[model samples]
Target: MELIAKATALVGGTIAFVRRMNSPQQQAFGTAPEIPEARKQGIMTLKMPAAEGWKDGHLPTCAPGLKVNAFASGLDHPRWIKVLPNGDVLVAESKEQAGPPKTLMDHAAQATMRRVKAIGKSANRVTLWRDTDGDGTAEIREVFVENQNQPFGMELVGNRFYLGNTDGIRVFDFTVGDTALQGSGEKLVDFKPHGHWTRSLLASPDGSKIYAGVGSLSNIGDQGMEVEEGRATIWELDVASSDARIFASGLRNAVGMAWEPVTGKLWTVVNERDGLGDETPPDYLTSVVDGGFYGWPYCYWGQTVDDRVPQDAELVAKAIQPDYALGGHTASLGLCWMPEGTLPGFGDGMVIGQHGSWNRSKLSGYKLIFVPFKDGKPSGPSRDILSGFLSEDEKLAYGRPVGVVIGPDGKSLLMADDVGDIIWRVTGA
Candidate 1:
């Protein structure tokens, strides 16, 4: 017995040593290319000398004769955006960070769990702007609301505007000309904070149901929440009833969601579990089916079982894997479908916002990519529709795009860059 125990210990030590020694590239399970900082910096900072033809005129890469435009510069971490019916854009600026005292405890007997006071920060504000003239510039900049918590994701449905904050979800009736949010908003739901705090909100086409993506509280399931509850799941709530339930389970973090125009299916770009040495699990873009499991804590990306967690053979068999996987750690967000009839170049394509990476030593993603589809599904490789949002010197990024919306003209595209506080316009020449 003693000899057997010694042998087991020796084997475990060897495995641990091997894992630690493996390079980040070797640990990555998929075909994601490792983007070195030097290369990323070079690509991001590459400055193009203004050519006479390309100097100030908009060139349409997606469609002929279409022009894109930008609006409102000098924003501070602008996030989640929506286009109002009046041709104005509504943006949520998330500026607050919940600190340590609010940490949750497993049991009531644990004396360490303490309540913390809610403190307000000046950075939290919501802004609205309108491009009244068709010149692609925001002529009016107005503050819609102020003194709120960290607001991230937003959905504009009918006459109401819904916002996803760190604490929970809130909604207000939106009036076009109102300078300040007049009436008190109603709270739809509340959640215990844990894991990644960025919550993304989406609504059904008819606005009957609302969905919110909540990230896992831990790197894996080490924090001990139910595998089927709270973290890593899409919460579905009836907009009018205010009742909520789990729509889907087992996604580590889904930051972006959109409804496909042709298929009418819900698709999401998910940020997979981290700490598997940078790239074990690849980020994914897939059609999310109700009650489907995407494998968190135990497996990843369709049957690639993880070694960190305890094995569950039955659960592994039941997990529904992603349809398409993007490169790992790309930090994908904000998916929007190209509308019909504006640009031939944008026909049947999906625009995804790669928010860029932070966990790895090297950085990847910082632009908008378009994935063309055949028969209403992703067909081939995605192409860079808009690049150089981050400066040529990758070390300092000028803009980090979070949300994308098709302009009122239908020929142009509008992107919201949170870090740079600027909205960029992409139009075809």
Candidate 2:
């Protein structure tokens, strides 16, 4: 078994190298990315940097005019962040649920994830971090909620605290100042669990509805479309009635979601499908329409048919082109609205945490980026807000960022680094 795993890893690396050599250096970003022809392989590319925690005082490299510090550390696999009304911060710390490997590729992935410390029993808890003295770092850390399914997204609307567990949305009664939840929460809505199991939650500005991002059960519905029902889409749940409906569809893994302050449109960062060329279909950032479809298995990048899934000509024609592309395999997650003046030199835009990639020869998106916006649309080139998550040779990763949220003071940004088990705070230098 060990020998087979080693061979699979070698073959995966060789495939990635060959693909990189054959493909042209095309840009996989911006309003219009150069989408190349697909280069499917029997075994997909699986290049991952071995995860290494930061040592001593090491920190991620902030872009010019910004500085970062550990807001809180020593927590279990922190993946999401939410700020409360009174400047308290909530962090959802969970890891990938373990499952038996069924194929050689699965075995290879499992081995790599184990090296990266990504495979573990989930902590299944949310921790509260308070910077009581207004310092950049949190002095108090407490487990605010515990003993739940793998929770990821969190939101508080009035006294109802909403948690997005892997299989459902749980609601708990709570007050603003309470440090811990008072009772066992009620499941407000059920969601399909496992396969791409992070359910991200975002409440409507009016507090009447909440949005949950449920990823596809399998890559391109290979597990059959029936199992994918209520998956691969953002669901809108009515807060009062607890009823839910699909808000948008065909987003393979829409993780981070935020409202664009200018036009009041919902925006999301999607992790596009892999196994295509190094930069075939780029992951995207787009304004999600109320009932829009951005082609998934049938096609990608607006009407370009994937040819892998059974053709859906009518659905392909209706696919909405994303507003902007982040890059192929960037895994852009952890989105938050950043108004002008929140960070020095950065105007109003969206901050995205690119948790990095493993399916490409050359790594992409191991950093936090900013997409400038004007009138609620992408106006300029994306810039790096924080980087140096990976070593210069790309063999070691210091951390993988996931969830990002603007601080309650509105002048700082807090990011969740799952690999480092730390919450990073960024402010003007």
Candidate 3:
């Protein structure tokens, strides 16, 4: 079985060379894709460009009047980043560990992982970078926190710093200007292990609680709904009691989230279900309502029922329509709102890092996109601001971004490029 899977991967690997895709029109970015009559979504497309590290002095394409630089490099697989109050940048160097294959599909998935070489070993640590002077780059690097269990998200509220490991949320006390955490941490909440392991976290405005986005274990409940009990939704947890409850449901994968600064509404970028052809369903960025269901396995983008999953009339009825559709299989993950008076002409909008497509015939979303927000709602089309992750030949990618955050000073943007092990800083020139 292993040998056959490996052979299949070789044939599939060659197809990665062909990634140029015929995507929908520009209107597809801000509105939902046209849902076709019910149909069984196709099998996996198995398309992906190999990660090729940047050549000497190579950088991603920046928008006009802006510039890009490697804020910090020479690290392991850094998946997420957070800017601390003290101007230190904390990066989560993590990757999913290869577990034993229990099903034939699992074996095939491992083979595909070996072929793409996209995900690397988790360093199980959060490294810190501090620019001692007023330089635009870091002057010192330290392991701010370590021995974590595939950690991804982080938030510091008052004296307690919270870190979201794949299996749990840990809290540690901290003081200003501390170089490293000294304790093992108090576990706040336990989570189901290692499917979509990135547990994205955000503290409430009042610092009384935090929200965590947990992704589904398998696409469209392929592993059965029984195992998906605590998955596919955001959870709100009380800071003092450590009590958690489901905040929203049917978000297949809420990868990045933030509070809309204007209205204090929570927003997230979701990785929608795949195999839905090239255009049937689109991933989205939307305001997450408390106790809202956005339709994951049984439906997508509001009332479009997924023909593949077991349907429930109640779930279909309760599904809330998303505000904006990004694009089909765009794999949009990272999101950060831009501050006012920082980048003129950008105005008030959110910046999202699109990790690009892996299942589409033609590639989409390999850069930073800006969606203008008016009065706390997405009011314009998402346009590319940074790009060129793909090589000219289209056979290789220099980077795939994950975490995106505005710097603490609000003057620059930081993006975590997991494939290249680099955190890119974007600033006005």
Candidate 4:
């Protein structure tokens, strides 16, 4: 028994060291790593945190001059958040579903996914939380929108409430202070369903058009590009016509997006394809341009070609390099900007919610990072606003940070903890 235990320990140690032989996150941040000699892999690394909930009354640690509290708790699987005009906050509770595996590699990815509690029955709802007395805690709460299909993003335009679900976009007529979502909603676009899931929606500044990003059906277009007809692309949807057109192409998974305050250009935090080794292809934050392409299965981080796909010289040549790299496999998801001098200390930059790393042996994210924007361009090192979600021993996860937004009052910050099943509020001390 002693000899067997020693053998197991040795194997575990070996795997850990092998995983760390890559670029540090700092090397991947701001600029893409100069991996002139990067190794490619057909297999995805499976180093995930054990899904565990926080103990009662316990909370995530906050940075100095900031205090964190459970603004609301007891949620099913709160993944995304939207703040309304009347100080009401909407939280989307949803889960993902995957098709049966057709290959050994697919089966293995599914198995690792199960270990991370990545799939489950759809919650299919969005709930409203309101702090009526100007307090941080939500005193009134109710189910705002129910019977939805794995909804992930929400937007409000005029009297309409738009929701981005797993398979389509739903729109409803709503008032400023209504708690219940009354309208049945109209589908703006029907998607191919499942795979990467979670379509992110962002209404234009003028509110006449909505920009959305649809994730690919497969990680690296392994299931064939035919299934990815409208997938893996950003869409420009006209509100009046309900007409959707491809805005950009070749982003593997554009999960979170925002418009740069100065440049007014749309930006996205893209989850790049997996199976490339730890340092090969870095997940990036790029300013999206209409008709532009960022290579997914063909090329990565500019013209550094990924040998996984057939040579497409024309497509590779047109692929634009991302503005900044947010570290490899960081799973960066949320984006909200606070103009300079608007908020004390944290003025004039974007706050990104990095949901942590599952593929790296040691976690890379699991925190809210502040990326400073100087004169409309990302500059300087990223700062951690909140962290310590992993346990002291790093064996279990207390929570995973997902959606982040500047509070309705514009003084506080709100973050959705999907794994912890709660919404955390951060206010200045």
Best by TM-score: 2
The regions of model 2 sitting more than 4 angstroms off are 1-8
lDDT of 1 by residue, 1-429 (tens): 234334433443344345434434532222243321211111111111111111244322333354445567666667677777777787777643535533222111011111100122325677888877778888888888776667777777777788887668888987765655756698888855645667788999999999898888766777465742677878898987889888987888887788887788888888876555445466778888998988887788777787767778887888987866666567787778876554546667778887765444344677687777777688777777776654444445545567787776777677776655667777666
Error of 2 at 201 (Å): 0.5
lDDT of 4 by residue, 123-240 (tens): 8999999998888899998999899888998999999989999888989999989998996888889887888798789999999999888999887787788898898888888998
Highest lDDT, which number? Answer: 2
TM-score sort, best first: 2, 3, 4, 1
Question: Which should have the higher TM-score, number 2 or number 3?
Answer: 2
- What tens digits encode model 2's per-residue C-alpha lDDT throughout 217-236? 88888878899998889999
Model 3, residue 108: distance off in Å is 3.7
Better of 3 and 4 by TM-score: 3
TM-score, each model?
0.78, 0.97, 0.94, 0.93
> Per-residue CA lDDT of candidate 3, range 97-171, in tens?
877788765665666554445444679999999988867788899998888899999999998999999997999
RMSD for all candidates, in order, please: 10.7, 1.3, 2.4, 3.4
Residue runs of model 1 more than 4 Å from their true location after superposition: 1-69, 95-98, 101-122, 177-179, 226-228, 340-344, 390-393
Off by over 4 Å in 3: 1-10, 13-27, 35-42, 114-116
